[model samples]
Target: MPEPARDPRLKSLINQLQPGPVRKVKVIGFDGVDVLVQLMDAEGEEAEIGRIPLYEASMRRMDNPSELFELGQEISAEEIGRWREGQLHLSARACEIPALRSFLLSIERRQIVTGTVSEVHNFGVFVHLDGEPDGLCTGFIRVPDLTWTRMNHPSEVVAPGHRITAEVIIAETRSGQVTLSLKALREDPLIRFADQIGRVLTGPITKIIPFGVFVQLAPGVEGFLHLSELTDEPGETSDRLVDEGELITVRVAEVDLQRHRVRLCAADGEGGF
Candidate 1:
């Protein structure tokens, strides 16, 4: 499938913001959720007006902009593109820690980065990137990006304090984060299994969702047998026809490489699989 075109304005904004340069700005005042500021030139003279949204004020969460900045306080921030109204937008969080900004700017997409796993949660894994600023954990691997294989939990693949190398998916200065992917370094199992389409295979039912059951054809390779494919008889639910761990014969119907999905159908002479 063709990729969607990006909005011209957004594309322009990204091009302008990425690899952005840090600038000096003095807080003029607070406007509700925004911090009004005056851009400072090299000579420390005020130039243009800039605004820092509350969320961009600091890397740490805070209830108010006043928590970090005071009136007329000179601070450093990166020019993060302009709002729709042409108001200059700045990110204090991006430059709040000089080391972090340098680290985020130095990394590139698909670059190999090493880090120590600091936490493992159901949603993702957090890492203390090797070159990141002190006391900051910037590397993160989302659950799906951890590996290509199906897993019950992230702990199955990595534990706290484990050193790992991953490919950088993105280095977002706005979020002060580097999204890493361990599976990008490994071969996709589905790509290897694609050649096996149309072959008859017998495997155990690993899981049964509302739509169908997942049959493990190979380690890390599972095929989805839709509930409708379970039996020719209408009104027969999957639970009534099959049980988890039950070996069932199926034919590989399709393998979607882009989507990383495998479709299966019951083998000939089999009522359900």
Candidate 2:
């Protein structure tokens, strides 16, 4: 069999190219987290190029880059100068474009989005938005958005790998952040508690702040008993009269639906309403 002649265009591209900042490379090889790519010239001709080190494959914590990128995957990258041995040191992470940012911004406020719980942090939950490109995680649900009721930790409402539906609360395109809220999908219990106004409700004191005692009338529904309403004592701390988890009788004095606040007074004690 006779050998076929090479394309003159491909030879010309290869001869004209020098390792500096190659773009639009295709993954031709992989080792651990490192990747070897076939660099494409301006004319889209492929030439043996360089490797992207594990550290340069992604911005996120990557145990194995191959898990995310596969052979023949086309990715843009920058060639960080050249090695003395005639190889290009590439950075694939730099190729992480703003596609996610633009997509998040295009998402309307209050738009429902489903995502898998990727991480549960002390302050919030990190969700990997569904339908988005893999490894593009920027969706966050703050602790307040995890549930309607008070939560000490995000894990109380969501665990890692839990699939959840949430509303887009804020889409910050500039910062490439999407804030989500699961609670927004539900009705506020405080609003429903309005009908309980002027009724005597017995519940446990959940918290005692300097300003008042929070009495849980129902799940996600709490009434504040201001320090002034707890006792007639001139200068007594709320802790002196109430303790968390202590059952108490209170008359719902007022329900401020607009502020999502409820005021309560002792039902029969010295501070009885």
Q: Number of the top candidate by lDDT?
A: 1
How well does model 2 score by local distance difference test?
Answer: 0.75
Where model 1 places Cα greater than 4 Å from the true spot, the runs are 1-19, 41-45, 232-235, 269-273
| Residue-level lDDT for 15 in candidate 1 | 59
Per-residue alpha-carbon lDDT of candidate 1 for residues 154-235, written as tens digits (9 for 90 to 100): 9999999999999987788878899899998998888778888899999999998866899999988999998877867777
What TM-score goes with each of the models? 0.87, 0.61
Q: Per-residue lDDT of 102-217 in model 2, one digit per residue for the tens?
A: 47546876789998999998988888887665667878998866776776788889898998899986664323467888987887777667778788889999998876888999
Model 2: lowest-lDDT 10 consecutive positions: 13-22
Q: Report clash pairs, candidate 1.
A: none
RMSD of 1: 4.0
Alpha-carbon lDDT of model 1 = 0.86
User: After superposition on all CA atoms, how large is the RMSD of candidate 2?
Assistant: 17.1
